[model samples]
Target: MRKSAAPFLLALALPLAALAQAPVQYSLAFPNAVHHEARITVVFAEVPAAGPLQVRMARSSPGRYALHEFAKNVYDVQATDSKGQPLTVTRPDSYGWDVSGHDGTVRFTYTLFGDRTDGTYAGIDQRHAHLNMPATLAYARGLEQRPAEVKFELPTDWQVATQLRPDANGTYYAPHLQYLMDSPTSLGAQQRRTWQTLGRTIEMSVLHEGTAAELDAYVEQSKKVVQEAAAIFGGLPEYDFGRYTFVANYLPQTSSDGMEHRNSTSLTSNRPLRGAGALDNLGTVAHEFFHSWNVERIRPRDLEPFDFERANMSNSLWFAEGFTQYYGELLLRRAGIYTDEQYCQEALNGLVGAMLNSPGAARFSPVQMSQQAPFVDAAAAIDPNNRGNTYLSYYYIGGANALALDLELRQNHKTTLDAYMRAVWQQHGQTQRTYAPANPYTLTDLQRILGEVSKDTAFAGRFFRQHLLGHELPKFDQLLAPAGLLVRRAKAGQASLVARLSFNPADSTATVGSTLVGSPLYQAGLDREDVVRKIDGQRLTSAKALPELLAAHKPGDVLTVEYRTRGGIRTAPVTLAEDPTLEVVTYETARRPVTRAMKKFRAEWLSGKAKSFYPKPQPEDKDVSG
Candidate 1:
């Protein structure tokens, strides 16, 4: 049976004077069985005098990547007035409904059969049902800023869980309509677990057929991630603490990704825990959780008072997603999940990938990437050379830039990004703080904020304009040299042991039919058709043993590799050049002062560690032109 609600705060009473102007509440009852119809009832408080009130599904939800015309699932919609007179409804857009000529309190009812992929509603079979709101339900236009109360009615054998605050009589009150729309609620025969941290409660709801052991492990790890993240961010916000819900649907032939929302985020992955271990999961969780501070609350002007029907364009995704990405990994490192080497490797890997793949890196600016995200799918198959050239991802390149600036700031001020972010929390994250519609913090505003914390206006201004807005790639080699790591090509004739390989496998036998261009093997003249027979004289029978063989040699080492070529057996003696293309920045204890300063400077100015979030304020009586 569905769990009963515990006693909680009472719902905020609507102002009596505004009752006539308020819209009626809507209730939706979603059944647990897949393909079973779900019913929705909307009661209008008062009908309009001229035209009937209209209701429509959202074109898209915040943090989601795709356009979900949510109204597609709706069926059998009916409307009636207070006098029991049937009202007429017509479909206007692919996801909208237009009600005709009603002037009294009207009740609208509809049934929906859910089949969703990216947001809100999901159905695989009779065994599981997932529903994420905002993407599933329609909100009243112009009333999106008002407070709301929600209730869920699930099957007797099913459970309903959400991060929204609970109210008296089992109903929940969203802090505001935006929160009501952003918090996704899931219902089904799901396994649920709860944890508390920093005076806030965390919940994990997995809607899979996995065993209890698996479910419990997933929940425990999720809690650990939350705790670790809170430690780095200086704890969660006490005023509006909310839960984090994980709706794991173990579907075959699907990939893993997540969408962040206010208070909660919905994640879809093939296996709840896979790749990069617990720390990797922790970083993922941290990235999403940090959004509560960065993107969800401290938003750009275009995103605030969001327009749900269209794309909200702004040249600030680099700050929103990119900085959040940097923090995600940084928080993990600070929490001790990743060693210095692992963290360096991850950062270098991302930078190398972006540099090698982004063809438009020199042409299209970060601003363009942020503004064009609504149209491009970075993961889709396209021309390889031009894939990222004209289509930069604010998440990747912007993140690298942010990380560079963050590290630079840390070195210069002898502090960390934690300090700057704390300032942002104090200034913009307060519940009482309301950002202006168009006056949201620009690049200058960010620099001012950083100046307040560090008193380094010059450094902040240079970093923001030259690296972030001007599109100058940092001198990464110099940045890591101070840490005792040198960036150089492996000596010729010295074949270093293989550090890693990027490949896409099609079969279980670990046969590499294709390899990523610029990968070690690809640079070593290992063609796409070459069947690997041996490495360093060891028979290359399985993919697992290749790593051990590669680890035997240092940066400068020669290897005799044998593989099957189309013509015949082929032998190649390849010298590893420190994998120069594979940029790895590390720390060294001893270095000359000049080299150290260069490294420090790179870390401070070029590593994307600039302290400013926006551009600097101009001088009085000086006219600036872009």
Candidate 2:
């Protein structure tokens, strides 16, 4: 996209009416749902008498930071006046169409092509329509504050599920365009459940070809997740839309994704809810539910008025997204959905693979990782880069950093991270205040809050400088020591191999994906993409063969390896060494003795017994609803 555009001059037009219409209206019909398309007509009830009125499709949407170029999905646009006379509509760009000579009422119709369903994209099919408003509706220029109403025309049995305020006539109302886009509407056969607690209502509407009993069980567990998340924030934030909705679509053809919104969220997966992969959906649920306050409210100022024309970038995503990722898993454990051992395994995978063992840890910082989000955060392209060797995901780094910071607060200061998070919520995300790009918290603000919460400014400065800005990571073995848990290679005490290679069936060759930075493989000129053709004069068809050939050999054996490099076929006489890869981490608990203080810290951090729920849960020994 070009960095500059024509100056917007809609204000130069004269007002045709004494007062603007109350709500800019949109009428949507899915008569051709069988063809995977929908007909949408938007009415700008109060257009200026003359000058070009700009109506454009968004280039991106909230909770997403890529250039989607939504205009590509729209076509066959037609415009007219209220009296049915055709109006001249000019195409200014791929995303915009300018209209003139409207009698204070501008109406346009367009066909939208939607076949994919995810948290960030819109999908329309014969059975249902998933609306991410930015991808579904076009907004008139300079009228962002205008209230809007949406009317859907579809099968009578197909119910409407959204966070928008519903009117008696079946239309939905939004205070402004921002709220409208933030509200996603799911129309189809929905299995709905509502639970009221603490003077607020939480709703779940699932669209799947599954039994209702599984949904009931899911709703019961979700209730516990909600309770635990609120306990961390002191209380749930004020939901301006009167409720928080969880809209999930689990179908065989749908894509998997979970996107967070201000008052609602979309969760989709291809796994069967009652079959083997059912439990996977619960993790995305725990993650998005916590976002009702994290990025949705305690947002990055730059992402506030979410840009629909370009990518929205923020340096604070390490906390905005990473800290949220941290609590998502933590809340699941606190709710008793995940056992202590299970939680430890989750920690080991992220801590070791993302921070400790990852070669990128020595090359990148959390801030640098967050800056790469626009390119890697679910980007559509499939180009390969140095991710395995020179890059790390902020999700991993941030989550690990959050875990270390949390354990440090509990172990050394006898304080918890929950109190600090609540302080942030109260100051940045409490009431009806809508944050914008100009009003976000900076890195300085985060350090200030940490200092205030920990009552140690010097500690805050040291933590950020040494651990955050630097490549060094927090020591997890020492941190996990307090929980009576330990992490080691899953192959430890069994095998002596650590090399990792992936096989390509198409070429019948093995390729090295990762190896110890300074190990023998690195010293022998085995680059990442070097195709291994043979080892010790033996043919190698699969990566499995490498381990089999070396099974009889001990450490410190010199061997000849032949492979194809980018330059050409080459043979290197490399010295064989013990494998140095930690493929999987083993998390063991209750295998060691636990001290009294260690027991207390684990109890308080792992379980929310340190703080009580608003409506206290049943017996402390009871597990979450099964």
Candidate 3:
């Protein structure tokens, strides 16, 4: 038999080594940003002899519950031995490859095209490199739990900002691939700042296409948001990681998105942090930072060990994502980003936005919608489909549910959702529960917590069955009344002809987006993607003119909608129907005055200065360093 080509095969096949002696290593270099590509190399210092080595691209990222097929961006892949000699690599599947004839050490060299910037995608240009870990790197099949090290050979002016802790020698290390996957790295001319609170450290790094003063101001206000947000969960989770980072990329080329991570977040936007639009950007900061406790730690059991090879669908995202959406804006209000009226407007928007997807809500429950993440969450739009007609986002449905539950808890239980969240925190979060995934909660577990907090198991069960697991919407009118708010119609209550018939506005050409199952739009023979050739003797060239003409009509008004089907142009008469709109009106008139009780309730629930519910930051936290 020929002697082995490389040594240390047994060591890699064994259990994970100490970080200092990790057998897996990665090096990334961005040499030619003009080409919009990065060269990535992975070296396995040791290899299993009995089996072929498999390398794979993640099917989905951590926070993004949707399938992104990150492999689609990977190409020019090749394998080599420890001495850089070529190895035989075979295609296993679209997302994976099998390598054989490798020395004890096998290395993979590939070029990845990444020119989109967001929290969940990879974007690289002469300006900067915004990378989501899953989108930028690949991993060995069985080395997900193996210790590894990552090195970035960046441009001279570029500084690397990532959540991965660095060793004394300046090399970033990951205890495992899972930890690595949760850490995103942005390499560019970043302005970095640091602050300390309650013995925990916060490091903010911003890479923007604006003046440095703007970034400085954004960081200053972000520190305040962090302070006010701590009150929601009583205090921050045990920041045993020693530090947390907030990585922001607000370049003109970056797509607007925000993704929560283990110790940091990837927040990108088209607007600079210095503009008048900066306040809106702060909401993304507040939202992702809160996830440091809620979803990241008090995670759904179904999503405990996130799948990297297939679409991971969870049924409890109604709470995981929806409750987070509810609190994201609520915390913004508490942080003074929104006025009393603005906050109420946001709540009203949430209610209406959810109901607009009513055709979907009418068929599926919040839980069902959450499970539809694979199809909707960050899902690419293919040809026209029924998503609009039957695909309400859990963000809306779940937020609406949260609004209802919060009011119920306040009115009936004399408790608030704040108490419930804190209780959940004490039980599931606190003490750095994010690192070691254990004691994850299920849908039933969440209901139990709610029942205990409300002191009514019946109410919790009913809420889950009807509002979460069933299609019944909450009674928003009753829920908002105690808080001096009630639903109002922004438009006439007359029936609508196409409230469910959506359109694409780019020179619309009478195209239909979706027709809800039972809407008059669906009954009018206007199917998805059908184009209207004429309606009531008018040659419809665009979608703009019909809405104005329809506004003058009401229910029982008969009209003809001539459109093109798959076969050819067709004509059908449609009866005008109701105007669908949801708005919340405050009790303001002198006759129906905003009552003292309602004012008190609203103040306590929305505007009043919250009592100091958390301990002050420690005295030793006077100095901050990064």
Candidate 4:
């Protein structure tokens, strides 16, 4: 029998023995002490021989729009083999590390100081807290897509929460390497709130110095958001999912914004909750929560197999970022957080704001803007001409386009964008398929999906090409007209007069940008850069009321004005002329009720259930690194 022992048996036995001898995977230690200071340590099974090892942080986290050098935060890195011997390590790039020499079991530890305005880490100094997630966590480069385990060691009293899969022992398990790298961990002295809806338990963790009453109100609003959003999605993704954490840093210097995460979002704002109302909080929560489905799960192809070393560009951000932006407010309205009037006003504000800012309304494409966003530095300093001529943020122009598309889709078929998204969810979300997997979802796939739901391939294709892919903005008024909503100038009769002054080429004093061609101001001889000091009895802070005051009088009305021209203070008398076209409005009448298709479309559009089909969550066994 000994002489007959097979070579195959011995080979199998040897491999099995090696596998059994491998050390039980342990945990990842992330220490949070100072708000801007932290450390990460990964302890793993020992390797018998030295092998090359690399670690990296993502170039940009899922929720953050700008490209961030997350790797810059890492410092004082060290690695030790199972025998407690130091291994040689070198940084291959700004975002990654390379290790050489033999190893059995190894532990990699590094101190990460995430204190900076333009880098990976963000700190809210006034609240004395920080939110560090995937942006600050590092993965073993190529191994990012593989299965790994993590454990957190935080400040004794601090609460830690994340969307990563958690094991029985509180160790977070990444089904594969990629999931571990993509999911972020949040740690701080934040107040946590928990709720249940649609057969799922949800949590809202907040970090603020505000009183408990204020925090409780925020939590209640968060629960309503989750409930409303879940109803729209059909159901929550997991029956026992982690809580949605809101890291609120009451930093007096912070602006109004929040970044989304897989299971949590960090919001920075100084606005008091009192006058803000539920609508405001609901909108904010909806925007970030929806990202879990859009950018987080069903991501752009380029974002998959992410390049942690540099920016990854994609033309599909219009769909990911812009479409979500459109849905954010719409969902709030559908959830009854805002009335129809409020929703319309918000939409109008976005549209008018975009149009009034630049003359390049029809020039830029969403895809081009998304691809080049990494190079556009400051948000405030962005030139409308530059955005108009070269780039257009999906958040603004693209969002407007999505709104039109939603309305158009409703008018064409009885189905709405909600159903289209649901079809996407059923097809991709349930199937866990990528846009172009080996079995990809192509343009044909999209067309077929839309056809199945709406029975209108022609309409879907036309909309996608003409508005989404093409540079042209739709006539939004046309889409809304069928619904009884009018897009028109705010008239003196319906609204108060508000004059806006435009600066001349010299960039000195404010002047008239445009006078509506036949406006009363034009007839009143109010030339550009007149710089009026007073109008009738009232001193003029701006030229806004000039037209209103003129419109108040008859065709033969006379008005007196004092102004500063190139010659300083002066006076002039001007006759007001009648405006034949005083106002142009787009509104709906009771005679034409919303069509059946339009009604269905509105229901589906307001509900976000349609997007559920794409980017289905991976199976429990699959790694999330991708």
Q: How many backbone clashes does candidate 4 have?
A: 36
| Candidate 3 local lDDT, 7-111, one digit each (tens) | 223223454343434447899998878778999999986676777888888879998877888999999999999888999988888887889988778899899
Rate residue 431 of model 4 by lDDT: 39
lDDT tens readout by residue for model 4, 1-626: 23211321232334333433433243433435445565667665544354576556566654444566766677888888778889888877676677677465567777766553221254523224354455656665323223566666654666555656677987776554444444544456666666555445566655455677876676665655565555555656542244444445443444556566555565656555545733454567778777656565545555554444445566666767777888777667765666666776765557544633333445556666666656653322443232323455667766776667667667777666666766665565433421112222334555577677778777767766666556676775677666556655443222211234653334233464444333445555565556756556555443444445555566555567666667677777755543332221223322345566555544555543423532453232121111
What would you estimate as the lDDT of candidate 1? 0.58
Best by lDDT: 3
**Cα RMSD, each candidate:** 11.4, 3.9, 4.6, 10.1
User: Which tens-of-lDDT digit does each residue in 238-341 have in candidate 2?
Assistant: 78767888988888778998889888898889887764456578878889999998888887766666666777787777788888889888887888877776
- At residue 287, give the lDDT of candidate 3: 82
Clashing pairs in 2: 301-437, 498-579, 498-581
Alpha carbon lDDT of each predicted model: 0.58, 0.77, 0.78, 0.55
Each model's TM-score, in the order given?
A: 0.72, 0.91, 0.91, 0.71
TM-score of predicted structure 1: 0.72
Off by over 4 Å in 4: 1-35, 44-51, 64-66, 116-129, 168-170, 239-255, 277-279, 352-361, 376-385, 433-444, 491-626
* Best-to-worst ranking by lDDT: 3, 2, 1, 4
Tell how far residue 560 is off in model 1, in angstroms: 25
